[model samples]
Target chain A: MLDKKLLEVLTSPPDAAVAIVTQGKDGPHVVNSWNSYAQITEDDKILFPAGRMNETEQNIQADNRVKITISNREVQGKSIKGTGFLVIGTAEFAAEGADYDTIKAKFPWARAALAIKVESAEQTL
Target chain B: MLDKKLLEVLTSPPDAAVAIVTQGKDGPHVVNSWNSYAQITEDDKILFPAGRMNETEQNIQADNRVKITISNREVQGKSIKGTGFLVIGTAEFAAEGADYDTIKAKFPWARAALAIKVESAEQTL
Candidate 1:
């Protein structure tokens, strides 16, 4: 699950970039998302809307293991802030289900929902 | 190789975060870098310092494939900018070599040098 620092970064900028890595046939693939439809449940489950994600969606279906990293939007202190968090998780696409509908309701542009269960988390402090 | 747009993003902020993904035994791993020891050669090769990068270094040694994502530090449009870039490349650690020495000279904190040859690149417009 995301800790205090991770939550701070994720919730900082609503349209902040979420860097996601998924394995592909050629090699590992990286995707940048300014997810307007991202959500976090009280249980710490990450909900991401899938809006026309092709290779990323396919990669997850083949293997659910993914890594995500985001920078802290605010300066941590008076010094130069390089605070970042890396999240390792398993992703499941919620297509045409209750969760999908909820995400769609929140973001009309969303076509499906990506629910992520965190495996572990780390940071560059 | 990195294209015009990618170069723009990579060279924008001196210490901007670099989100990197590498494959491991258990799953994919992501690392964020504020690389004060990164260099770009005229031939389009990426030189990054391997400053105590344990897991990431091992992963690249086992498989050179890696994907990197970075957000543009500047706005690209008249409205809100959400420009991001993804780089697919192969990495090799350079230890006790000419490149390693060069990196060490530039960044005294560098332990080794990681050279990356670009394979392909994409983006989230």
Candidate 2:
């Protein structure tokens, strides 16, 4: 079971650093950085920023089942780590939401974005 | 950076499900299961259970750096995921510590075990 505090951080409406590992022609490549979490629905759909030309977005388009690792740390000396399948069923530019103005106003660098449906979840220690 | 509560669960001495992705002779493989967390030192050393003949232990012995994903889900509609470098420096039987008796008494299936040193850490969403 996941600890209460760790879960809250993951489900909270904030940006988080997501590490995406994919099988490239060269080898296994990993990208580590911060991306804003725009929306997470009760049905397990998660929206995040993914520029058009990024390797992750491309890989997701080619392969639907991509492994994503999400994590958060707490001051109470604990941490939560979630590993699951990030099923990318759709992609679009972030110009169609109520928060679109806010996102565009703040993140002018994002060229494109994507919406991911989390098909399954498992708690990790 | 990590949220306060998430960090507490990771550093706590409870067991967690660690997804270890490794490069095998065949191809990239992943193992999803649960393991007990014995000790996490101030120097970023993390100890977990690994039998002598497990594929993960063998891979760690051959390769120093292994990708480990840890996760937790909360009742508050949040989750935390942590991805980091698990450096396996040492491996030993659990019969030489104060907690050894307890661990052995509880987990008789663990034929051998390992102590991992976490060299780096990253939070993911």
The count of residue-pair clashes in candidate 1 stands at: 0
TM-score of chain B, candidate 2? 0.57
Candidate 1's error at A116, in angstroms? Answer: 0.9
List candidate 1 stretches off by more than 4 Å: A13-16, A35-37, A73-80, B13-16, B35-37, B73-80
Tens digits of per-residue lDDT for model 1 on B1-125?
Answer: 45677767666643456777888776677777653345887677777777777898999879888877766646362244646666778888888877787778887888888777888777666
lDDT of 1 by residue, A1-125 (tens): 46777777666643456777887876777776653345877667778887777788899989988777766545362255546667788888787876777788887877788877888877666
Top TM-score prediction, candidate number: 1
Q: Model 2, B20-114: lDDT tens per residue? A: 55544433334443433444435544545544436655555565455555433321112334332222133333435634444455557555444
The whole-model lDDT of each prediction reads 0.71, 0.44
User: Would candidate 1 be rated incorrect, acceptable, medium or high by CAPRI criteria?
Assistant: acceptable
